[model samples]
Target: MEKLVEQVWDYTKHAKFYSYRPNYAPKTIDMLITLVGGKNLKVADIGAGTGNLSIMLLERNCNVVSVEPNDAMREIGIERTKGQSIEWVRATGIDSTLENSYFDWVTFGSSFNVMDRNEALNEAHRLLKKGGYFSCMWNHRDLNDPMQKIAEDTIIEFVPKYTRGTRREDQRPIIEARKDLFDNIVYIEEDFYFHQSIENYINAWRSVKNPYWDLETKEGNELFEKISQKIIERLPKEFDIKYTTRCWSAKKYK
Candidate 1:
């Protein structure tokens, strides 16, 4: 776990590119908030990278505590979310150091995969008041789309055995396994389209944590350049990428 935490520091170099990544679906976010009893609730957003999800929660009128461990990412998050009803904290999902039984909800937006799952769930349970919800979500590219299929082929051409890791996996089992702490699990997935300039779309790849290639290395840079060139040649100046925000949530139990 310590090593995993250390490895996340690598995001320092890629922090700036995070802004190019697609955001979770707003409609799905509203659904999650409604399921947990509507807005104006207190939320702890773990691994709140660059304040993406935190900003969404804030816009929905939730008071948020944005907890992120990486300095570079956290700094960007702080800057992007300045003047909002948010408190930025330096912390990890396994041991957030947040108040016990204080928050109405604890969420991990595109971040639950980076931590020890069971430990993170325990921490979330500890931070939530009775009946509060624990939720985690990721915005996944819809590979079935034509453009996305092209991108997927390009990635496979570079790294044949590429896998998206736990972020793309069904999270119900993990949360359900901890029945002693949580129950009434629900899963929601909503598809949405994101429009971006071709340049930013290519740059968004830089923020991905690909274990197959280290973006800092020469080989990694070469792979990135090749993929970017392919996209530049194949894609239009501005286009939409299909995305699906998949979310899992459960009520905390005693």
Candidate 2:
């Protein structure tokens, strides 16, 4: 599974995936800012894919260390954030090589599930000063929406082995399990909707390399064909998809 994820993302260019990916609601960004108390605080955005979260942080006047291991994604991130003074570092969550007890905040945006959670949390705790914050968030597809349920269910039936194609985990239980590492651990969630053309939506899934690669075989293509046809036939020309961005934060105590 891990290798499959690496395989998929390694080829992920900064085009449609970055362009069509869901945005973390502005209010959620504001909440993270509030949790950390303000802007211009030092931040390490681990797994900062294409610098989406870093861009948000920079807009709030935060100094960002955009750590991403994938060169393709990192390059696109750098390209996308051109003229903005973001410090882009090529590193993973467990091996950031950043200084300890220095950054005011550490964050993971839609990328925490990729890491060895315990190691990453420890690294996050180590890199933050006493009372500094560490936060992780994801823009999750809300399964409860009617249109979305059809969409999700269709994919599941078509791709029986389908998981989110990457690790789909809730960090709350892990956070609580390692309570000794931090203080005031808390979780926050909010729902927002975004609309995209059905084509763009289908293209987004096509960008998911693992399943798409597997489905590239004769047998798999048939399933994807069905999914595409269903989307075209059932969904509106442009329709809203509900997403929940769940962010969890804690302050390092020791």
Candidate 3:
């Protein structure tokens, strides 16, 4: 196993932590489906956390190959996609162990940042046919919303080192500099509205992440509670937030 995969898979293995995550809007998935433009196409969804994106592709009648490294997370994904016909493989993005020049589409749903980004791109390029599409997408909180701003501020205050807004932005230059790895690169972002309860929202934050996972620790527990209470006291019973789902895609040129 690679160092990055081993480190992330071991530290973040809890499935319940992801139960409250906000789902990508149907329109977002629809756009991806339209891009690929065919039924029963082979799609590899790496970092398929809890099978969110895989489930969508399966519904569209695509043959989805879900590859995830964490057992707990993959187990939950298996459970979520039950009764559906799909392939599950335990693998990381940079080295999925899948054969080359076969799949019609390769996707990373929110896990691209955790991967060796350039290597993953190389692998995705290898796995796809010449005309195959590669897409990476994840939802971002629209912090321009005052409620979201409050949430981010509280998160940063407790975790001081948190880079909620800057993590993806920090990686932009890498994507820009590596255009040689893929061709006709383009980015598309769409804003979608979502509604969730405060309790569910906080629990979604409790995922098995480093420093933030061990809520049993004095420091961890305090930080977790502080953010939770602030959200409850501040937000309404049924609050809405805007989520921007961003997708980056390119083609495997001949």
Candidate 4:
């Protein structure tokens, strides 16, 4: 499974995947800024694939350390932020070589599930200053929404079985898993709404190398073909997919 994930991460260097990957919601970025009480705060974005969240932090005038494991993704991050003064490091959450109490905030956006949760949590604790914030953000599909349910169910049936089990849309497990690492744990959730056309939605999935790589078996491909047909036959040409962007912040006590 780990090898499979590594292969998928390597494939993310492709032009289509690098260019069309979905970004973190602007409102989610604003919430992170608000949680830290201001901008220009030193930040470390863990598992910072292609610098999606790092770019968001940089846009707010914050100095960002983008830690990513995949060389391809890290290069894209560096390329995109060439003149923006962002520090791009090829590192994962667990082995980030940063010293203790180094950053004001450590953020994980849509990349938490791919990490060793326990190691990553401890690393975040080790890197944050006293009273510093640790945040995890994800753009989750609202399973209760009819359109979201359709899209999600289709993807689930088509993708590799393990991918479905390994990742989840809910944030509770991650928050609960890391609760003991921080003294003052708090959660804040905000909806980042977007109207995604059917093509846009499909392309977004295709662009995520991990998920697409997992959908490679003959059975999986057949399932995906069915899904694509269903999407074209039933879903509106343009429709809305609601996302619940859940963010949890925990502060280290002095």
Candidate 5:
């Protein structure tokens, strides 16, 4: 997972990674908005890759601080957010450069899986004011969807053994971890629907530094390319891709 995280910073500087990778859905935006009960909520987005989630919060009229460890990714986010009112910090979640009990909401979107889960959650608890919410949201793809199925299967078939099972985006552990730190635990699941051409889909997959590409053997590289080609063949020019955006929210307790 750490290797993947490092590669992501390198890959995301490319146009493909910076522009084509999936963004959070408006439903995700709505959930956070309502969770904090306002548009101008103070937010700290931890492990905020390229400010994807932070940008969303800013658009909803929230004051946002984006904390990221990767300098390249942080730069992309900074450039994308030129003229916007967001503070970009070069720090990780475990030690975000922010005062304690300073924010109303601390958010992690598609980022918690990369964090030291316990430390990140504890940091969030400390940074958020009493009753302030800590929210973590992730876009989990439905592999059953046609185009998505092909992509997932191909990646699974070719992904390097080292990267396998490194990070599972399960919400349970984080939820349970928060239980002892915060009161009033809650979970919400929302769906986002989209239609994409196979070209777009392929572009999206290749945009991220694929673990399949990290396979160190010639056989692995060959296998990955073969699977990529097969994906292009099997997927339709246009197909529906559904993602479930699962969010867990909890309020800091005294």
Candidate 6:
């Protein structure tokens, strides 16, 4: 478990590129907030990298505690969300060090896969009020889309066995396995389009933790360069990338 925490430091190099990543679908977020009771609720956003979801929650009037372990990511999150109703804590999801039974909700924004899921669930249970909710979500590129298919082909051309890892998996089964800690499980997904310049789109890939190779390695650098060049040749200056924001949420049992 400690090793997993240490692995999070790899994001230090990719921290700056996180902003180029897509935000959660607005309607999806609104539905989540509504399901979890509503605005001005207390939220503990675990693995809150660079304040993407945190900023969205803040915009909806939620008092957010952004728990992030990576120094580079957390620093950027703090700077981006400065002066807002937020508290920045340097902590991992499995052991947030937050008071027990205090928060209305605990959430992971594109970050649940890095931690031990069972431990993260336990930590969420510990931090939430009796009826508080726990949720984790990720924005997945819609690979079936024409433009996205080009990106997929580009990646496969470099790493033939590339896999998206656990982030793209169905999380319902994992959450349901912890029946003792939670109940009333729910899953939601909404498709949305993110518009960005080709350059920013390429930068977003820099933030991804590629399973095939480490970006620091010579091979990985070459692979990235190749993909970037291919993308530039194929894509327009600016375009929309279709994405599906998938979220799984459960109510903490009293």
Candidate No. with top lDDT: 6
In candidate 3, which residue pairs get closer than 3 Å at backbone N, Cα or C atoms, i.e. clash?
A: none
The stretch of ten residues in a row with the least summed lDDT in candidate 1 is 1-10
Question: What lDDT tens digits, residue by residue, belong to model 5 across residues 130-247?
Answer: 8899888777677676667677776666553524232345666656756878767777877777777777766665544444463345875676568779888877778878877777
Judged by lDDT relative to the true structure, which candidate is superior, 1 or 6? 6
- Provide the overall lDDT of each model, using Cα atoms, as 2-decimal numbers: 0.89, 0.80, 0.78, 0.72, 0.73, 0.91
- After superposing candidate 6 on the true structure, give the runs of residues whose Cα lies further than 4 Å from its correct spot: 1-9
Cα lDDT of model 3 by residue, 98-130, tens digit: 999999999988878777788988899899998
In lDDT terms, how accurate is model 2?
A: 0.80
Instruction: Give residue 89's error in model 6 in angstroms.
Output: 0.5
lDDT of 3 at 214: 65
lDDT tens digits by residue: candidate 4, 67-178 = 8877777777788889986788766787787878989999998777776667778889899988788888776666787787776666676653625433455655665766
Q: Who is ahead in TM-score, 3 or 4?
A: 3
Model 1, residue 219: distance off in Å is 1.5
Ranking by lDDT: 6, 1, 2, 3, 5, 4
lDDT per residue for candidate 1 within 1-254, as digits (tens), equals: 35436365468888999999988999998899889995599999999989999999999999999999899999999999999899998878887879999999999998888888999999999999999999999999999988889888888887799898888889999987999999999999999999989899888988888787678899888878887898788888998889999999999877
The TM-score of candidate 1 is 0.96
Given candidate 4, what's the lDDT at residue 176? Answer: 72
Residue-pair clashes per candidate: 0, 0, 0, 0, 0, 0
Candidate 4 global TM-score: 0.82
